[model samples]
Target: MGFSAEWLSLREPADRAARDGPLAQQAAKAAGPNPLVVDFGCGTGATWRALAPYLPTGARWRFVDNEPALLAEAGRVAGENAELVEADLGEMDALPLAGASLVTASALLDLMPEAWVADLARRLDVPFYATLNYDGRMSWAPAHDDDAAVTAAFNQHQQGDKGMGPALGPNSADRTIALFEAAGFMVLSADSTWLLGPDKAPLQRELTNGIAQAANEAGAREAASWGRHRHAIADRTTCHIGHIDILALPTGNLQESTHVLR
Candidate 1:
């Protein structure tokens, strides 16, 4: 389930546009001044770039990823204030969380199992901010007959093991909220959908390809045909992909948890 830097770079703009800005602002405020933030699965530092401007001036960032190349690129992009740590998120027990004021991840939770997420929730005592978690809603303008089948198959594929046991897929946001709440955290969530038009042809094509691949892997017989048709009309089509941004603060302090976005 490794993603190339090129693919991550391609999706950066849409990712930025789709994230909940107000939620990020709330997270920044909740983190306090000069917070030390630990970002998991920080691919190419897009999440860092998206949140850095909203956070305090002297805030420190620790970017954790298992990919060395991505870590290098993140370090280069995030400047000297960022410390890159190469570690496997699948093995969360060994992760270092010392002195962290906030924990964050983007496009990550949906790929993990419920137990893993619960473990993370139990371990994290600080405020948590996660964005771009897939909510399983995919729509296309100028719809085709095979759209539903492909989407269903892809969603099914999303639930299969992705190195962390059975993934939560579209159920991630709700599961995350419940997990954190059970761990004494107050959670707030917001919709962060990606609306792709002709202007985003590259991302559209990549997304189509990825979906088709997943559907095919899930044993959808018409996936290849659907992919070909989608690619042919992608330049003229629009796609709406759903996601969620969440912020969780420890429940003890009502004042700090009250600053969440509605």
Candidate 2:
């Protein structure tokens, strides 16, 4: 299922804060001047907003997403330098990669199948910057006895098809990096974990509820009570949800290279 604009908006602040600044800057610098950056699953243009300031002046963007409503919302804020393309990302063969100097996506790779990611790596001759991929590490403060079980079920649910076939889930970042490296790209990645404190109570509560629902759907019947406990204490509890940001640049195509590191 496609994410709503409201959800995207709710998560934007954390995504912005958690992103690795130096890695993003490196991708921007590697893009050079007047680059045409194509963003897949753009989701109200958060990725563009996150990277625009670092990119050279005259940089343009193509925001691609399957949802028309989300694309329209992205267009509302993307202004003159951005173009909106409504297309299903599942069709890797028809992606709008022509004339693209850089490619980006946020919270997207973990939902894609391994084959799809490999295909994307083979087709991209430009630098690829992807962010906020889930890494399956989650912890809650004032831990509950059921926390581990609920989280395990949620992670399993994440592997179910989210639009593409079977997803890579927590393994997405490592798999994508390996694929890009095999295709001759130098990849750099950093932990971008969302460390939510009491100030982020709303997000923490919503995320806990989502996890509970996913866990229940994956057959963890006890997660309902676990969710209630977590939700009730959300305002006082802290959360650590692991995520990763990756920047992969094609060798020889870019002047700079960063060695792959965790």
- Candidate 1 lDDT over residue span 109-225, tens digit each: 999999999999998878899999998999999898989999999999999999879999988998999999999888988899999998898888889988999999999989999
Clashes of each: 0, 0
Deviating ranges (above 4 Å) for candidate 2: 254-260
**What Cα-based lDDT does every candidate model obtain?**
0.89, 0.89
Highest-TM-score candidate: 2
- lDDT tens per residue, model 2, 1-262: 5998888888889989999998888889878787999999998999888999998876999999999999888888878888999998999877899999899999999989999999999998899999999999999888889988998999999989986788999889989989999999888898899989888888887899999999999999899999898889888998899999999888866655454565
* Model 1 vs truth, CA RMSD: 1.7
What global local distance difference test value does model 1 have? 0.89
Model 1, stretches more than 4 Å misplaced? 253-262
| Model 2 pairs in collision | none
Residues forming the 10-long window of minimal summed lDDT in candidate 1: 253-262
